[model samples]
Target: MILILVDALRRDHVGTYGYHQPTTPFIDELGARGVVFEDALSQAPQTLNSTASLFTSRHFPLLLWGVEHDPIPGVADDRREQWARTPRLAAANLTVAEVLSAAGYQTVALFNNPHQHATSGFSQGFDSARLLDRDAGQAYARVDSLTTAFLDWHSGRDPERAYFAYLHLMEPHNPYRPPAEYQALFPPGSGRHLYANGPPPPGFTGSDLETMTALYDAEIRFLDDGLRRLVGELELRTDLEKTLIIITADHGDELLDHGGLGHGKTVELELLRIPMIMTGGPVGPHAGTRVEALVRNIDLAPTIVEMAGLDEPGDFQGRSLVPLIDGAEPAIEPPEISYAWIAELRSLTSAEWHCMRDLANGRLTLYHRSEDPRGTLDVAGERPEIAELCLAALDRLEAEGEEARRTAEALKTVETDGAITPENAAVLEQLKALGYVEE
Candidate 1:
């Protein structure tokens, strides 16, 4: 199985998702031969928390929401101490990698995102996990570099053994800098600098936003080119028909949608709705199928386990999607629940509505998804009934998360002692260059 995760890649930006731009020709081709989920969402809007859920098949602890330097009431003042106290995937939780490894499959991972590095407890189940080095001199490693590394690794693997390889590409994240050729593809004047140093300046014109979006689209196009090459190589070197290839994003970015410059700040549709395409392997029967049902990232691991014909761990919170893909009704309808947190803001999303509450001030803003997909129009005052329903759902989800946290705490698997070390100077510099951190 091969899993490709692109960082900060919004679904609407791709051609398959109805965008006019030819930003994802290769991905669109993959969609043609695979199942395209119209309403797939990440569990969280941030990488660390969302990926933690993906790897462990459990909801990330709500207590660690803003522990990364952002102050939380009644929490430790020191950021490092907060990280130490933050719950990680316990040894008790069997990761997809560990399960597959035990089942005689080689599990490997190549990621450019620093949040998935070894120190983050994301390397738990992999036989080999390689993160992009800070010395690579770029915030996002080039797609070619990652593809080359993967091809090299696969070259040495045993041909008869089944393998699970994950590739996390960091293109299209931030500081949008596509190659010169791709930059030239856009209109000359449309490439003018916008928010090159910081957030979009006040009084920024619509043209400026357009230019920024053009740059982001170009980044996607660049990555698509690399994917074309990589896919071609895979077909030539291996049996493409039997390989389960899943392409998705860790989370989508907010390109001024809801007036935000980046993600993890809001639970807007653009941030939560990600692209998910599954092709080959057990999904062959579902080729060219588009499932409109809501799917969550947590379902990925269990689906893979089911596809590999292995027994899923009992603690997995997500249901397998194989039945849905194979034209059978799901045994249990998934709950219409999606949760997101950043600092003092928390949002609960359902298929038709989104409700956000500011924990610091107890402010509530509700949006009807069908009427206000961008989440700009607030209807909480006009539609009290919908607002109350959303709030009630949020309350239930929070209670469930609290119960899960208590269980994890009882396992005593959380790292609670100086887990967050001083930032590596090189990694810190790359994050700054990508505009993820302030110098």
Candidate 2:
């Protein structure tokens, strides 16, 4: 099985997802031959937390609030302190990679996201985990190079083996420097205030949004071309049909939809919704069909396990998605999609009402999707009872989340004095450039 995570890919940017551009033609083509999940959501709005939830099959509260890089206040003394220990796995959350590895599948992960650093506990089940690093701040090429190398390594292995490959690409991420050729092919310039190259254009608007989106689309096309080549190569291989393949994103990017340059702090549609599609192997039907039923990243592990015909762990909160893939209306009750912005918790009902509850203080915001799809208009004051219902759900989720955090923390073994050393500084600097941290 191959799970390819396209970093920072927004759901609406692809042709299959109603994007007018032909930027993601390859992925769009794949969707035609596979089950395309239309309403897949990320557990958290950020990469590290979302990845943790996906791998462990747990929600935000069940996993640690922050990974080794994005540390919450007082959680650890320093960055090094966070990295020095073997992290805890959420109770009853077993990585899909672990399950596959134990079932005679060789699992390898080729990741470029710094959040996937070994210290983050995301490397738990893989037989080989490699990180993409760079010189002179250019790293996307490193990801492509490493991915190609990893594929070559696996391809050279025994042909009879069934393996799971996780390719993590950080294109369309920030440092929005798509190659010169590609930059010319799309709308010009990174839209938001420039963090690196220079000052951003003034009076950004929907047109600028389209322009920046064009550049991002260019990057997506870059990835698409590469992935198409990879797929073509695999088609020539002996076990193409036997190998399962899944392509999705860790999370989406918000191009200033809610006054944010890059992702990490928003639950807006542009940030939380991502693409999830499966091709090849044991993935069931609904081929070429879109399933709009709400699903979250936490469900990935359970889904993979169920696809493999293994019993899901009892305590996992995420339900398997096999039924949806099999072209049936989802048999499982849809869970409310929840997200967090620092200490504030937010949730959305499958029916369309979205709610936010501030944990640091008592405040509630509610929006009815039918009326305010962009989340521009707040209807909390207009509907007190509905707001209360959403707030109550958020409160319950947060309470449960707090307990999960405590449990995961309890599993940790303290190791360092919590100081950020030179090595830690290097990593943090990369994260900062990636908009994962502020200087």
Candidate 3:
């Protein structure tokens, strides 16, 4: 099975999701052949925390942000003494890959996102957790090339082997530099042009929106081409009849939506809602059926394990997608989606409301999703019950998550210097370029 992660892909930007541009013809086609999540949400706004939850099937607050030797408060940290004592895989946590490996599936991870690298302890269970080709700083760079190469390599290997591969592609993330040929869609004064040139130019204008959107669309096209290639290759060699393929993203990016450029710093829907598609085996051809029920990033790991016919480890916070894939009505109630923004915003969400508390200060902003889907208007004063429920959920999830973090930390023996490693230096560079990091 092949799992492709398209980093920072906005749900609204794709044609299937109603964007005017032909930004995602390939993905739209994929949607026609698979189930499409209309209201999928990420566990965190950023890649590191969200993906940690994805790999471990745990809540973001409980996963310690994918750094070295840190633990989720209440999980599995108490077993070890120092951070260094923690292996890439901690005692209590088991990645989907590890369980599949034991079940005799060859597991491989080829990532464009550096946080999925071994140094961050995310590569724990894969048989060949290769980081693939990347500069120390542009680890996520050229993700398409890496995906294609990995597929080629996999195809040449034993065809009879049951295998699982996780591939991450960063085509739509910022420093939005598609090739010059693709850039032709945008003029020099456009936001996409300006972003490619360097940072946001002074006094950004709305007139540039079209060109900026065009450039962004062009980048999405590039990734789409690569995705098509990978899918075609998979169809040719794999047991496409029974093999399961899942495609989704860590989060979405905001192109001047609510005045934001990148993700991880905002609680806005533009950055939170991602695309989740599961196609393969018996789940294929369930296409174009939009599932309005909310799904979280935490669900990926558990779903993967269940698909591989393995038992899910207890303590996983996500629900398996098996029932949904089987077209079974959801038996359990939907989860209350929660996100923490240490960068600037802290928020929790339920099916009815989105409540954000500024991390910079304690000012609160509440939007009733039932009343204002655009989130253009704040109604914290108008709806006290909604606000109360969101806050209470936030408080409960946060307390549990914090406890997990503490437990993980207490079990580890290592200390991180707060400096970026050579492997993560490229991620730091992109974060700075996206204005997620300063100085």
Candidate 4:
């Protein structure tokens, strides 16, 4: 089984998702040969928060780790302490990798994102997990290097045992500089000077935004090509009759959609809605089918477990998506909840309404799901009762999530690695270069 996660990949930018440009031919082909999710939302709008849920089958807010969005008021004052407070995948949470490993599969995770390095507990259940080949200071590691790394591992692993490898690609993230050859579809031209590392570019005009969008699209194209190469190599090395391939994004990027260039700032559709595709194994029976029902990122873990014929484990909060692909409804559906730490925002998207509230300022925005899915037309004032109900639901979820987090943290108190250390300076440097920290 191979799980591919592209960082900062927007849902609407892919060819399969209705984007006019042909940025994802490879992924689109995967969708055609498998099951596609038309309405999938990430639990959080950033990598660490988003991926923690992906591994543990828990909502972002419900995770035991510190919510970095505001848990620490002065992030820059002490980088070491900040790293100490870094949102983590607590050991208390049972990860899908652990489940698969115990069930006789060799698990491996290769990623470029510094936040996902073992320090955050992201490496929990894998036989081998490491942050692969990234260059210094905002330079992305080539996708080829990552594939090579995986191949190195595959070549040495036990041939008879099944394998589960998770690869997290960073091409779609910031510093969007795909090689010139990859940019042939959308040349940089005059907008090459724009920097996408931090917040929105100052004095950014309409034309600059267009250039940013093109660069991002080109990045996706580069990612797609690398993915095709990696899959081809795997097919050659081993039999693929029982292979299971899953593709998804940690979260979507914000490209001036809500006045920002990076993510972690909001829970808008651009940041929360991601493409989830599954192919091979049991999914082969449902080829070329698209499931239109709403699904949360948390459901992915449970789905993988179910495919392995394992029952749900450790208070898993999501239902397996296998039922949806099989054209059957689940016993119970989870509410659609999306969250962001930076904005202190929490949202609930239901069949009838899409609601968002900025908890920091108590500002609420509600929209009719079918009529105004983009949430452009605010109807909070016109439909006060519905908005109130949404707010109450949001409040309840937050309360429950907080309590869950507390329990997780309490369980983690037994671990001895909580001390602050000077090595965290390097982590802060990586975070700054990656635009997680402001100057």
Q: lDDT per model, in order?
A: 0.75, 0.68, 0.68, 0.77
Instruction: Judge candidate 4 at residue 266 and give its lDDT.
Output: 78
Worst 10 residues of 1 by lDDT: 65-74
Candidate 2 least-lDDT 10 residues = 409-418
- lDDT tens readout by residue for model 1, 154-250: 9999899999998988888887878889978754244344553224567777777777788888999999999999889999998898999999897
Which one wins by TM-score: 1 or 2? 1
Best by lDDT: 4
Error of 4 at 300 (Å): 0.5
lDDT of 4 by residue, 1-439 (tens): 8888899898999889999998999999999999999888888888888888888777743243553322222123344364556666666567889899999999999877767755667888999998764554445566788899999999999999988899988988887887788778877556643655346667787777777788888999998999899888988987664789999998888777666678887777778889999988889989998988888888888999999888778657777898889988643355554443433788787656778889888999988978976667889999999999988988887887766554444434333334334544454455447443345
Tens-place lDDT per residue, model 2, 1-439, is: 7888888898888778899877889998888888888778787677776777778766653344333443422122454464433243432346778788888877888767655655455666788876655434574444457557766867676667777788888877876667777777775754442422222356656666666767777888887887888888778765566667888888787776667667765566677778988877775345666777778777777888887777787646777887777767554455446454433646554537666655556667777867886678778899998887776666677777765554444332222224465545554455457443434
Candidate 2 clash pair list: 78-418
**What's the CA RMSD for each of the models?**
9.1, 8.6, 9.8, 8.0
User: Candidate 1 lDDT (Cα, whole model)?
Assistant: 0.75
Model 3 CA lDDT for position 135: 42
In model 2, the runs with Cα more than 4 Å from the true position are 61-93, 135-137, 141-143, 189-211, 330-343, 349-351, 414-439
Writing each residue's lDDT as its tens digit, candidate 3 over 1-439 gives 7788888888888777888877788888877777887777887677777677677777643233344544422122443234333334343355677678888888888766645544556776788875554544442457567766687669665677788888878888875666776666533353434452223457767756666677677888878877887777767865675777778888887677676566776777777788888777656656556676777777777888787777887757788877776668664465546564545557776667788887568677898787888788889888788777767776786677666555444323222334445555654455457443345
